[model samples]
Every structure is written in C-alpha cells, then in structure tokens.
Target: MEALEKSREHVIGLFRVVVGLLFACHGAATLFGVLGGPQGAKPDVAAWPGWWAAVVQLLGGALVLCGLATRAAALLCSGSMAYAYFVEHQPEALFPLQNGGEAAAMFCWSFLLIAALGPGRWTLPSLARLRRRPGTRPITRTSSTSSL
Candidate 1:
C-alpha cells in the first residue's frame, strides 16, 4: 500500500514537471522565437499582454518545475491561461474547437489541478530530504561480511 501511494505521488509529480516543461517551452517560443515563432523574430518585450503573459509563463513554469512555491506558480499559470482563453479565443465562437483555444483551456485546467494537488511526494529528492532532521543520515543497505 505504501508503495502504491509512492507510485501515485511520483506519477503526479512527473505530470507536473512535464506540464511545466511544456508551458515553459511555449514561453521560450514566444519570448525568444527559438522553438518556433514569427519566423525566429522575438515578440516585442514592450508589448502589453503577450509579453507579460510570456514572462509569467517562463518564471512560473520554472518555479513549478523545481517544486518551489508550486501552488502559487500553478495558480498564476492557470489564471494566465484562463485569461488567454477568454480574451483571445472566447469571442471567436462558443466552443474551444471553433475558437482555437484548446491549448489554453487545457493548460488552464492542468495548472489548476497542480495548484490544488500540489507538487506531491516526488518533489526534487535532495530538496525534499533537506527538510529532515539536520543530523539524521539517510538509511542504506550494506553487505554483510559474516555468514548469516
């Protein structure tokens, strides 16, 4: 049962990391125009909403990825996606299919889930262990020299 619980936590953590990575990629594409954007031309840093959203995505995604302030970062990311869906896509049509807002909707929900559930037990191993008693040593197996 404990193993199963740990497995579930690891899976959730992996999901969070992957989502953060994808979100960060979107920011990189828009901010740096590296992955694919406007033929390699970066978005204007002074732009109103687009630039601001990208900055949030980049920074928030990183925090989520590292499991640091995961809840707050996920909340911000979720809000940004919600804003994108409503402001940029909702006016086009009633459904996401017609509005071309599938990604936004998905990201919004994903980040919301992360915010609610948290980083889980699989948060970066070293950092997680740092919370343990200062003088405590991690347990490890050792080979027996004498016959059992």
Candidate 2:
C-alpha cells in the first residue's frame, strides 16, 4: 500500500502521457489522414465541429502531454469529448454501448480525471525548475598544501 502510494504520481504521469498521445493520434488521423486515416471522410478545411474538434484535440493533447497548462488542456479535451458523445452519439441511443460512443465517453472521463489529479511528476516545467534550482551546483575541488 505504501509502495503504491509512493508511485501514484509516476502512475498519473504515465496515464497523462498515454491519454494525450492517443488523443493526438486521433486528431492527426482526422486532420492529416495518417495513422489509418479518419474513421470517415476527412473534414474540409475549417469545416464545422469536426475540423474544430480535431484542432482542439491536437493542440490540447500536445499541451497535456508536455504537462504545460495540463489542467486547462485536459478540461478542454474533456469538454470536447463530452460534446462529441452527447451531440454525435446520444441521439442514436441512450447508452454508450448501443450508440458506439464508448471511446468518446472514456476520453471525456479520462481527461476529467487528469484535470482533477494534475500532471504529476514528469511535467516539463517541473523538470526545468529542477534543473534551475539554486542548490544543485556542480562539485568543485580546491588545491591545498599539506604538512606531514
């Protein structure tokens, strides 16, 4: 239990990285027609909802992955997914299983969790701060005369 508690931050960091990567990949597929391409026809440039959603996914995921403005990015991502689920999926069916909205629902909840929990230990800004900390100086040697 203690070990699990100690590793919680690392686990959260890993979770954030994975979720961000997956979301980014989804956006890349939709926008650039890569990674197996979009599930359907690619949206026209500056198209409604679809194009804008893709943009948010790409930018927000990148920010969350880097742990820069993670909470805000995650919140945006969550909202987007929630919109996707409700607007695109729920009309077809009341439940995710029936409507094929599992991915959207999952992403929405995952991002919400990330927003609440934070970016954990592996944030880029935190690493930069660590590097710039005042006390972590390099060792130095001084010459001294010795008498026996």
Candidate 3:
C-alpha cells in the first residue's frame, strides 16, 4: 500500500502519456489515412463532425501528452469521446458491448479520469521549471557538471 501510494503520481503520468498517444494516433489515422488507413473513407477537409472530431483528438491528445493545459485538454477529449459514444454508437445499440462503442466509452472515461487527476510529475512545464530553478544551469555537452 505504501509503495502504491508513493508511485501513484508516476502511474497517473504513465497513464496520461499512453492515453494521449493512443488518442493522437487515432486522430492521425483518421485524418491522414495512415496507421492502417481510416475506418472508412477519410473525411473531406472541413467536413462535419468527423473532421472536427479528428482535429480535437489530435490537438487535445498532444496537449494532454505534453501535460500542457492538461486539465482543459483532457476535459475536451473526454467530451469528444462522450459525444462519439452517445451520438455515433448509442444509436445503434443500448450498450457498448453490442454497439461497437467500447473504444469510445473507454477513451471517454480515461480522459475524464485524467481531467480529474491532473497531470503528474512528468510534464513539459515541470521540466522547464526544473531547468529554470535557481542555481540550476542548463545542461550542455561541454559542461563539467552532469548532475541535474
């Protein structure tokens, strides 16, 4: 229990990175037809919900991955996934098991969790702060001190 508690933040950070990476990959695949190509024909540029949804997924995922504006980005991602589930999948079936909405539901819940928990220690902003802290010098190849 003590070990788990101590590593909670690290676990959350790993979760956030993975979720963000997967979300970004999903968006990229949909938008660019890469990574085994889009589910169907790629949506036309500026197309309705499809294009917009992909945009949100890519941008929001990137933001969350970098832990920049994580709360807002995670919230947006969660909302988008919820919308995808309810509007796109729920209409076909009452539950995710039969609706092919498991991914949507999972992503929605995962992002919601991230939004509530916040970004953990590993983040771009945190790294920048560490670098800029007093008495800390920016690392360089020629620098004698390797610590930091």
Candidate 4:
C-alpha cells in the first residue's frame, strides 16, 4: 500500500510538471502573440479588455502548472471558462458542431482535479521534509548505582 502511494505521488508530481509547462506555453502564446492574438482569445464585446483577459488566463495556467496555488488557479480557470461558456459558447451550443467552449470545459476539469489532488508527494513543497521535521524524541540513559 505504501509503495502504491509513493508511485501515485510520483505520477501526480510528474503530471503537475507537464501541466505547468503546458500552461506556460499557452501563457506565452497569449502574452507574446504566438498563437493568435497579442493577448490570446478575447470575447468580442464591450466586456473586459483583451489584455486583462489574457493575463487572467495566462496567470491561472501558470499557477496550476506550478501547483503553488492549485485550488485558486483552478477556480480562476474554471470561472473563466464558465463565463466564456455563457457569454460566448452558449449562444452557439456545444462543440464540434460549433467548437463551442468544449476545450475550455476540459481545461476547467483538468485544473479542478489538480486543485483537489494537488501535485502529490515528491513535489518541491513536500520534498524538503521541512514541515515534518527530522525525528521524534530521543532516548536517554539513567545513571544508577545498580550492577547487572
């Protein structure tokens, strides 16, 4: 059981590393206009400006990938998706048929899971052993006048 747990932890830690890198890529795309916009995808409206939207998505992705603020990042991403869904995708309906917000939905779910389970053991946060400390109590000897 312990072995199983260790393997699971390592797997999740690796998962976070991959996720973080991916998020960084997406963030860079938005920040630097690699994919499309100078600020990534932006809803066409008088809504929030494209620059702020890009920052929100990019930052959330980074946090999720880092596992430093998993829940918070996940919530932000999820909320972004939800807002996008209603504001954009809902009018058109589901995906494939319209490519409607499905990708965003998946992103939401992935981050949500990450938020719940976290990056697992072997992560930088847990690897230091700083929180648990080194050892327990020490044994001491008593000086008695008895011979054995």
Judging by lDDT against the true structure, name the best candidate: 2
Kindly report which residue pairs in candidate 2 clash with one another.
none
Q: Once model 2 is optimally superposed onto the true structure by TM-score, how far is the C-alpha of residue 51 displaced, in angstroms?
A: 0.3
For candidate 1, the lDDT comes to 0.86
Each prediction's whole-model lDDT (CA): 0.86, 0.95, 0.93, 0.64
TM-score of 3: 0.89
Please provide, for model 3 over 1-148, each residue's C-alpha lDDT reduced to its tens digit, 9 standing for 90 to 100: 9999999999999999999999998899999888987777789999989999999988999999999999999999999999999999999999999999999999999999999999987899888887687987867776476678
What are the clash counts of all predictions, listed in order? 0, 0, 0, 1
Task: Please say which candidate is ahead in lDDT: 1 or 2.
Answer: 2
lDDT of 2 by residue, 3-85 (tens): 99999999999999999999999999999999999888899999989999999988999999999999999999999999999
Encode model 4's per-residue lDDT on 1-148: one tens digit a residue: 8897769877877776676566556656756767654433544433464555556677777766666666777677767766766676667765624755766666666666777787665555564455555685445788879778
C-alpha displacement of 38 in model 4, angstroms? 5.4
Off by over 4 Å in 1: 1-6, 38-42, 125-148
Q: Model 4, 22: alpha-carbon shift in Å?
A: 2.3
Deviation from native of the Cα of residue 99 in model 1, angstroms: 0.8
TM-score of each: 0.79, 0.88, 0.89, 0.64
Cα-lDDT of candidate 3: 0.93
TM-score, model 4 to reference: 0.64
Local lDDT at 80 for model 4: 72
Task: Compose the digit string of candidate 1's lDDT tens values, residues 1-148.
Answer: 8887769877888989999988888887788776766323465886878888888888888888888889999999999999999999999998999999999999999999999998975566546787778889867899979976
